[model samples]
Target: MKRKMAMSKVPGYLVEVDHWNNEKEHTVLLAENSLLICKYDFVMLRCERIQRIPLNCIDRICHGEFTFPQKSLNKREGEGLRIIWDRLREPTFLSRWNPFSGDFPFCTFTKHPVLEANDKFTKMCALDQFMDQLTQAVQRAHEKKPIPGNANRVPVLKHPILIETYVGLMSFIGNQNKLGFCLARGNMGF
Candidate 1:
């Protein structure tokens, strides 16, 4: 089983943490069939949760500045990549209340931290390369689909999602910044 999984990894792709992971970095693996987010405990590097998003369902990908209402507290400062799929546009009020509500249809990505420290790691986890690879994988997934129902629809999710927002409550700030993200502080109060 492990051997099969190893064979499925999309070459030239490796770990690059997105902002959704908060302060702690998460390993993101781009497998041929799906995108996997591996959450690990910092101390022992034990895998706690693995959230997988299949490539076929991906409908849109956007790379741009993080835009929010002018007065929004959650407005972040930088360009980010958002990967969207076909699903409900908004989350329910109750679901938004959940700290672990990472079940959103889209995943936003930011520059990986490791890229800042070393140029070698930067190339391995380059955002542009990742985006290109993801686009190719999505195209392959859609092109090979044998579903009769999808025959009439577009054969590929080649659209770039640009709609940021007009104005409304900011849900992404809380939803993406999970409780586990910023739990660690270096000092530890000696």
Candidate 2:
């Protein structure tokens, strides 16, 4: 059967990486404040000193600095830490487009039989919630109140669910039309 295409809109965060070790024990020393990590191959690094090294060579390590956009920082220490960590991780596609806008999108495919399998989808939901909170914090900082029921004000997509539903609906309509056409043809043949 031919496969159908699907897409989704999601929010992403940036992360810094301190260190990572491959199965063969090869290590990649990434930016100390980077959050995005190799989920299957390596574990997240936790260290006292965060450093920035050349993307090509680890031995070329050096102290690096990053500055968040003005008015983005707030009084909450925890929020600040999370935002900084997320920025390091590189969570969303929009990160590259416009850091201030905080818009991003992501899409993936799966052949699993169970539709509601909890994996990346759950993570996406959590990230959406986090983004919503962050947006609210930003609004509050501007002396504005968050709109009721519009927490994230961001689009979060559950890819598998969306794909399945779309396919199912299309299939149902196609089958019904085919049945109706067959019935009409038989009546005319009579």
Candidate 3:
């Protein structure tokens, strides 16, 4: 049998694909801010993992830094960064299995899963650099809505449930799409 070759769009520029093949894990590349494209082969075994995320959909990134109180002789501390998508929907079963409903931690950006598992100091540096690059890219990509100075001129409704119910009913009758129904929910319920 033969093996297929994998290559990035740009050889030495725009895209820089990374490869890590060890006893612990294997990944062909970590492209953009939200994908871990993996490729591996062993004798008769072959596998590839692909995760494509739309960066425009990300709402923000969180950098968590904290320390735990010392129950022993020394205090334990850890730091990490996470990618917070504006929408909860994800393509993979791995992500779908662990939904980020604000109640749970978002898709982590810290220590590339493969690196974190190795427990090396390089993990910290890698995560820090990744966070910085991701943050910059997100800021540049995300567009902010400008608030009108006279925004207060518009009337504010005290009761919004009536409007919400009306939309929901209309969507039900019209058989609206997922996005339409989502809006009708008013709070993105489920």
List TM-score per model, in order: 0.67, 0.18, 0.36
Query: Which residue ranges in model 1 land beyond 4 Å of their true spot?
Result: 1-3, 6-24, 146-190
Q: Report the error of model 2 at residue 17, Å.
A: 14
| Candidate 3 wrongly placed segments (more than 4 Å) | 1-47, 66-77, 87-105, 112-125, 143-190
Inter-residue clash pairs, candidate 3: none
- By descending lDDT, how would the candidates be arranged? 1, 3, 2
lDDT for position 21 in model 1: 29
Residue 155 Cα positional deviation in candidate 1, in Å, after optimal superposition = 11
RMSD of 2: 22.6
| Candidate with the greatest lDDT versus the true structure | 1
Per-residue error at 71 for model 3, in Å?
14
Alpha-carbon lDDT of model 2: 0.25
The Cα local distance difference test for each model comes to: 0.54, 0.25, 0.33
lDDT (10s digit) by residue, model 3, range 59-107: 5555664222233222212454445453345445443333222232234
Off by over 4 Å in 2: 1-44, 47-125, 144-190
Q: Score candidate 1 by lDDT.
A: 0.54
Clashing residue pairs in all predictions, respectively, total: 0, 18, 0
